[model samples]
Target: MSTLPRSLLKNLDLFRSVSEHDLDTVLQIAQTMRLQAGEPVFQQGQVAENFYILLHGHLKVVQTTPEGEQITVRYVMPGEVFGIARAMRRPTYPAACIAVEESIVLSWPSSEWDHVIARNPQFAFNALQTVGQRLQDAHTRIKELSTEEVEQRVARCILRLVDASGEQTEEGVSINFPITRQEIAEMTGTTLHTVSRLLSSWKEQGLVNTGRKRVTVRRLDDLIRLAEGQPPGGTAASKRNSVEPL
Candidate 1:
């Protein structure tokens, strides 16, 4: 058994729906682990013996292509669960998980997972919902990559990140954490030069403001226009209404 702070324990999804007694029982089997930025929590094909909930900072899920190029699959933020291979009954991890920032995580051994799920059907239902959402997001990204231009794909990627983890400021909505042009390129399957050029163009048009490692949307309308591949005007406004707000 490992000791964990009460505050962190309270926020984890697996514990949230359970009764107080169950929550305490679950915590008795949990361990807290700390990871440094750029540290590998687990490698591809590693044994899936434990599941984790991110308590702080960010994690990147990545896979390498046959050609040896690394591609980012998704960014996992605090309060999100990762290492679900055990729960899903996979013997090994499908993708590698790395800390994008210094992070803290709560881990439960695979043995406890079966007991928890058997006792709490809600946990199983929630896990399925999370998987479904991820599948939808993957499908959307695949469609964008197949059909959209590099600029539009990049725009949509940024918009999704902002919606997931953005902080509102007087200037605009800032992505909650730092991101690099290289990471953006990897995510959108575009060249670094292309990302830089497109972002510069948006800046010139007053659509965004870029800092050293941050991006803020200044004119959301203009960004939306680029994302939809539409000329700036009435068509963009109509599209905006249909887009769910972040």
Candidate 2:
């Protein structure tokens, strides 16, 4: 009871159509879990046994590279549904989900999915929507990777995070999650050195202020300009020099 995430029907748009009784019935199949930061909720290629709804805190989706390097695909915020590999008919997870901080989730076995969705049509709709969204996000990332340079991709990634779960503060707009330069580099398909150097340059130009596990955009417009290849207060001559490996 206490484990149930703030009524799913209220927080998740896809579940809005489900009645409390229906929602509760589905939840009856759920098991609540608390995970420590850095712990894995699910590993890549593991059996797909459960579907999860993040109750609190954050999660990172990661995939392994050919060289055995782990690249971050995306970050999940609270109230989102994840671990839907069964919905895709995959016997194993394609990627891993790890907790970014102490987090809670409600999970249900894949075996119960049909029963749950049949009794709650909205559940089926929502599951499909969630999977569809993952496809769209992947498509967008592919476009960015092919069309944008490292700096632009990194800038867009930061802005996307800020837009997703940022909190406005006296300092500036900060991403409301624990993120490291290595993870950002992985997410943008670049090297950590590149991300660190670009961030250092941005800080000097007053475009952004970064801290441990936090990034605050001081000039979002300028960052957007930079992402579009517009040199912000810096000339074209300096742009190449400012962002190395361009």
Candidate 3:
């Protein structure tokens, strides 16, 4: 049996509606896992034996192409449930989930999925809601990739990260995590060189402050304007300078 507090599960979105009795039932099956940065919780195409709910820290879901290139699909925050290949009726996971920082997760055997849902209606509802939201996000990403310019995509990606994990600080709104330019490239479907150059230009224009694996938005309004396809400086020449051939 897991030694973690029972109240911890209650705080998670997946278990928020579950009653005390149902929570106890879930705790009986859950196994706690600790992971270091760069460790994969599950690899792409692995048999999905367990579904997990992150208790703490961040993770990134990545999919590898046949040509061996990796693309980041999304970032997972605490309280989010993941790795439900069984629920999706898939034999194996479609992507890999890797810890972006030191993290903790609670996992239950895939075999127990039906039993748990059969007994806990609220949990079943919550699980379905989670799956629906993810599908919507995936569709949104597909749309962005199909139509948006690289510059707009990069700006929008940063904004999404900020929405997920941004923290207010003396240095404006900080992303509050270690995210490298290469990872940003993967998320935005651009080259690392392109992300670096755009960031450098934004910095010179006093829109952001960046360091190794860190980014802080100093001028949120200007960045939003750029993301919306408007010139940051409200001029035609500024718009021309903002976009470059990839």
TM-score of each: 0.89, 0.89, 0.91
Residue-level lDDT of model 3, residues 183-204, one tens digit each, is 9999888899999999999988
Task: Between candidates 1 and 3, name the one with more favorable lDDT.
Answer: 3
Off by over 4 Å in 3: 233-246
Model 3 quality (TM-score): 0.91
Off by over 4 Å in 1: 233-246
Query: Best to worst by lDDT, what's the order?
Result: 3, 2, 1
Candidate 3 has an lDDT of 0.86
RMSD of each: 3.7, 5.3, 5.1
Error of 2 at 107 (Å): 0.3
Best by lDDT: 3
The whole-model lDDT of each prediction reads: 0.80, 0.83, 0.86
**Winner of 2 and 3 under lDDT:** 3
In the range 59-158, model 1's lDDT, one tens digit per residue, is 8899888898988888988877778887777999999999888889888888787787776677777777778889999899889989999989998899
Clashes of 2: 0
